[model samples]
Target: MSEAGDATVDRAHALDAVLLGGPRTLTLRDLAERSGLDLEQVRLYWRTLGLPHPDADEVAFTCRDGEALERLARLLHEDHLGSRTMISLTRALGHTSDRLALWQVEALVEDMATRRDLDDPAARRAVLDELADLAPVLETQLLHAYRRHLAAIASRYSVEFAAGQDVGGDPAALPLARAVGFADMVSFTRRTAGLGSTDLSDFVQRFETAARDVVTQCGGRVVKTIGDAVLFVADDVRTGAKVALELARVLGGDLDVERERGAGGLAEGARGVTPVRVGVVWGRVLSRFGDVFGPSVNVAARLTDIADPSTVLTDPATARLLVDTPGLLLEPLPARELEGIGTLAPVRVRTA
Candidate 1:
């Protein structure tokens, strides 16, 4: 092997020791025997992590792997967890962590390349070199954040259950009452047309980061961000109204105070951020697989489609709920035909 190849292999071994809590000294068959699991069961568990399985004889499993499998087996035995539920839980962890790890690593690579003026391959090597030192810190932070978020979700559910707001039905059904909304950038394609990759990345990131700050400060949680839009949810209509109105004012440059602050040091090219139109509705929604659905979600999306830039359009139901909300002005728009939703009156919401 070439010297570079030898060096790469050495680095890989070092990483294996650090990350896997030991070298890859066990094959799949060995792991199965050690963990007291069948070969098919071992494969099933491995596949649930969204990872490709190695050959049965390949020495790719570590002691840590065996230990993890043993723990999982114990849980299954103790809790009598069904195969379906086990697979679902494993898949959720696998999917979420897979994307999250990729995003974090890529962000690190970008930071390395930008700060050190290294090329992509070099930056990747640098990241690998630093991973041994960085991995533990990152892992700790990840665990802490996950625990905090889980606690928050559980607390909210407990409160709702206590308040008699629980949706009684199939436990797996999606029938939570929520305030769902979408904010879409105006003329996104036109605004970003012909921009270079770097410029476009900055533009999108700036908008998303800023939008998230506003949403969080206004007591809303960002569900996800599409290419040119953000989906958000709040526990109630009032909080959702605050989120929608604040996003419009901040992103659309409607707030004189914010404008006076001069874009808060955003990139020069992105200083003139694109305006956004918002739509919100309060109704029962089906929360499934990290996303939301149902008629209310559909109505909010349709309202966003018809809304003008820098404005918030809300369904009449939500408007009625917020009729006496302080610091908000609601003007009822004429009944308009929306595809798949028939004619409905949407209220234009703004600062009082």
Candidate 2:
């Protein structure tokens, strides 16, 4: 083997030793036998964790791996969670951790590069040497964040879906009534056309931070971000309107708000980010796999497309729900045909 290949292998083993708490001392069969789980069960569990299944004869399992399998078994029997659910949970962990690991490493590389004025490869090499110390802190933070989020979810579900509070909600809905909305940047491509790496990163970060703050401040949940746009949800129409309007007003606001909130705005040394257009709809949506899906979501997206910059839009039905809402005005706009959604008479919403 080449000397470089040997060095790479050595580095990997060193990382594994630190993270796994010991050297690998067992194979697939050994783990299964030690955990008293069926061979196929262990294989499926490992595979579901976004890990490649090594050869059954390969000694690639460590004590920590074995302990993980044992814990899974205990969770299943003790909690009575079905195997399918456990597998799904395992997949979620694997999928999130895969991206999270790379994201953190890249962030570390950037920090090292910027601090030392080194090139990318040099900074990455330096980072690899320091990662053993950082891994434990990252692992602990991940666990802490996971537990906190899980508790928040439990609390939210208990209140929102209380025993018989609103399960059979509006529109013969999926569960509870929700306000789904989208706020997207205007002329996104033109605004971001020639931004350099650092400038673009700053531009995007500013928008995301502003958008998230807007949603949370107005009692809405940020579902996800799509580069130049944000998807959000609230428990009711009023809250949705508040989120959509605030998002448009905050992130994609007029020149005055932009100067107040984000001085540089859109791109550095470029024209500020133009006002955002928002679309909100009240309806039931399916929440699965960390995303929302339903006709309402689609309608909200369509509405945002047609909304005027720095304004909020919704369908007539959704607008009606907010008619009695205070400090808001809804105006009917000319109906337009949207693909898949057909003709929709949009209502423009503005703060009173």
Candidate 3:
């Protein structure tokens, strides 16, 4: 092997030891035997946690791996967690953390390149060198964020559902009744046409940061942010209205179409972030896979598509729910044929 290849391998092993807490010393079968789990069961757990199963005879497991397996076994026997639920939870963690790790690494790489004035390859090597030192701090922060989110969820459900207020829904419909919506950036493709990596990252990060702040401040939860849109949920129609209107207001502006078309599609808005048109609907939705689903979600996206920039649109049903809401006004727009739902009047929601 070349000297560089050997050096790379040494660095990788050193980093693995730091992150996993030891060298890989145990085979798959050893882990199962030591953790008191069946070989197939261990393989299933490993695969479910977003990893390919190691060969039974491959010495790929570390002490930490065996300990983690033991803890998982204890959850099954001592905590009595359902097998399916345990597997699903483990899968969720694996999936989320996988994306999260990649995102963090990319961010660190950008920082490294900018701060050290290195090229991309050098920046990546710098990140690898620094990551071992940063790992402990990052892990602590992750735990803190996890605990805070769990507490917030618990408190929210306890307060909202503890009174036994009926969350009425059709027997065959999607279960949860909540307000779900999308805030889609106008002229997204055109506006972001030729931005370089740094500029593009800044624009996207700014929009995401701003949108997330507005949603959380309005007592709403952000379901997810698509490439050029944000999906959010609120407990009730009124709160949803507030969230939608606030999002439109905060991210407001019509595309400077002439300037955009003329000047390489430079977006017009606060900090060059394009304006987002918002659509919100109050209806039942199925919650799964950390995302919301149902007809209402579709309707919301359709409304967003038809909405003018920096405006909030809603269906008639949702508009009616907000008629008695204070400090809000609803304006009916001309009837238009929504893609799936024939002709219908969409209402504009704005702060009064």
| Model 1, span 154-268: residue lDDT tens | 9989988888886676686566889999999988888788887666866787788888888888989888999899999999899999999888877864233343555554333
Candidate 3 local lDDT, 1-352, one digit each (tens): 9786677678877998899998889999999998888998899889887887768999987999999999999999899989889888888888888889999999999999999999997788788788899999999999999999999988977877876534465468676778998999888888778989997886677678778878988999999998889999998899999999888877764334333533221122332356788999999888887899999999999998899988999999999999999998899999999998778799999888
**Clash number for every model?**
0, 1, 0
TM-score of every candidate relative to the true structure:
0.88, 0.87, 0.90
Q: Name the candidate that leads on TM-score.
A: 3
Candidate 1 contains a number of clashing pairs equal to 0
Give residue 127's error in model 1 in angstroms. 1.1
- Model 1 scores a C-alpha lDDT of 0.85
Candidate 1 — which pairs collide?
none
lDDT order, best first, reads: 3, 1, 2
Please list the C-alpha lDDT of all candidates, in the order they appear.
0.85, 0.82, 0.85
Residue 216 in model 2: lDDT: 82
TM-score of 3: 0.90
Off by over 4 Å in 2: 1-9, 161-164, 169-172, 253-274
